[model samples]
Target: MKRRIAILGATGSVGRSTLDLVERSPARFEVVALTARGNVEGLADAAMRTGAKLAVIADEARYDELRDRLEGSGCRAAAGAEGLVEAASGDADWVMAAIVGCAGLVPTMAAIEAGKTVALANKEALVTAGALMMDAAARSGATLLPVDSEHNAIFQCLAGSRREDVSRLVLTASGGPFLGSSLEQMSEATPDQAVAHPRWSMGAKISVDSATLMNKGLELIEAHHLFALPSERIDVVVHPQSVVHSLVEFVDGSMLAQLGSADMRIPIAYTLAWPERMATPSQRLSLTEIGRLDFEAPDLERFPALRLAREALERGEGAAIVLNGANEIAVQAFLEGRIGFCDISRTVERALGEIDASRPRSVEEVVALDGETRDRTSALIAESRP
Candidate 1:
């Protein structure tokens, strides 16, 4: 039987890459639903292309437009948070929880409660509410698979190994567009330059995170949660080529690594076809042409985001939530030309300083904390500006 799949963020880059795999062999999969936050046109296009049965737009105002666009196409349309939750609860064998940021949490939890195998691309969900998500998965028997390249690589390497035999997880980084540049050079960096990642193509926010090494930082927190490893066991290595996704060091003095082209589809397909690998049309890695891979330690003095992320993960009083929430706000500010690239980490650090001592007990509390941090961080940026 063909697997029933619902893509939670069908209009973004990750969603598009997933669509490529599903579209290639429609006989192997069915797209039950597709959703976008506000990209009605893109959502409609994706729905029609996939012949999805349901489409939802998180922006309620765009519902009428989405509904009209999908008219005569045999796909139903919905709007708002309720719509998002309903779509997630619908009949689907698997849900690609690809909604970019913290906004993806509730619906992703809904998918988990619905007992769907969740392909998690939204790192914030785990970073902010990993314990909650893991608990939900354990309760509901939902399989939560990691879709981020680093986490996915670690997953592959540790497939049949005992947790005790595992030594550490080493995540590779592309080092972003400012790899060779000094901190002085980064202070005056522009958004376009930051988003121009050294290896992988990505959106402005994530690309900016790469520039500050904060993307790696966020991934570290995600790894800590997803792999059930502590902050000390997971490490980040700067690999500019982007060929080696991640490595798993064993207690026996050896390491296992997963290497491939920097294509999102590889990991997406890996998760989608878990336990049974599916062939992907991604560009094959050419080690001959891309001769050598270099490794180096991340510069903590230059990229304080990584250090801040470690501190947040350690503090645990909604610090990860604050770190992610603040970074999101600051990244948006920088992208809008409201702040400097360096100020992104500054904003996150300030939010980290103002954190509530109480840790969030539930996903609801996590969401609330994320919202509160975003609001606070936004104000902090504004106050610092003039």
Candidate 2:
């Protein structure tokens, strides 16, 4: 039987790539539902291409437009965030949790609580409420599959191996566009320049995080939850080539790595076809043409986001949620030309200082802290600007 799938964030980068894979293998997977924030054109196109049974727009105001577009397409239309969450958890065997930012938490959690197998592309869900999400998964028996290339790579390398035999998991980074720039140079770097990632194409917010190495940091918190590993056991190395997605080291002094060309679909396909591998349309790696692969230690002094993220993961609970929330606001401010590039980390640090620290016992508590951090971060950005 074909797997029924619901893809949240159906118009975003990962979602588009996932649609490509599903379109290719129509017999193996059926697109039961698709959700997007406000990209009606993209949603309409995706629904038509995938023949989704239900299509949802997260913004209620766009309901009429989305419905009008999907009219007579035989796809049901719904509106608002609740609609997205309901569509996500409603009777689909697999849900692709690809919605970006903290906005994804609710829908992704809904799928988990419903005991649906979730292919998680949203790092914020794990970063913000790792304990809450993992506990929910444990209670509901949902299979949480990692869709990020790095985490997915680690998952593949750890196959058939006991968790106790693992020593450490090393996540590889492409180092972004400002890989070797000096602190002085980066402080004045423009958003356009920062978003020009060296190896992979991604959305603006994520690209900026990649430049600051904060994306790697957020991934660290995600890795901890996904693998049941501690922060101390996860490390990041800047590999500019992007050939090796990630590495897993065993207690026996052996390291295993998963290498692939830079493409989100490879991991997306892996997650979609879990416990089974399928051919993807991603580019294959060729060592002969690529020549040499380079690796370097991530400089914490220049990229303080990495240090802050590590500390957040160590602190647990409110820390990661706040860190992610603050980073989102700061990055937006920087992108809007309202703050300096380096000030993003400074704002996050300040927000961290101002927010009260506590162990978030529930998702509600985590969301509350996240909102608090973002508010404080926005105030910091405004005050820091001339």
Clashes of each: 0, 0
Candidate 2: where is the Cα deviation over 4 Å? none
For each of the candidates, the C-alpha root-mean-square deviation to the true structure, in angstroms, is: 0.9, 0.9
State model 2's lDDT: 0.91
Q: Output the number of the lDDT-best candidate.
A: 2
State the weakest 10-residue window (summed lDDT) of model 1.
Answer: 197-206
**Could you tell me every candidate's TM-score relative to the true structure?**
0.98, 0.98
Candidate 1: residue pairs that collide: none
lDDT of 1 by residue, 1-386 (tens): 99999999988888889999999988899999998999999999999989999999999999999999999999999999988887888978899988888999999999999888999999888888988889899999999999999999999999999999999999998888888998889999999899998788876678889999999999999999888899999989889888889999999889999999999999999998888999998899788999899999988888999999999889883888899999999999999999998999988988889867468898879988898998889889889987
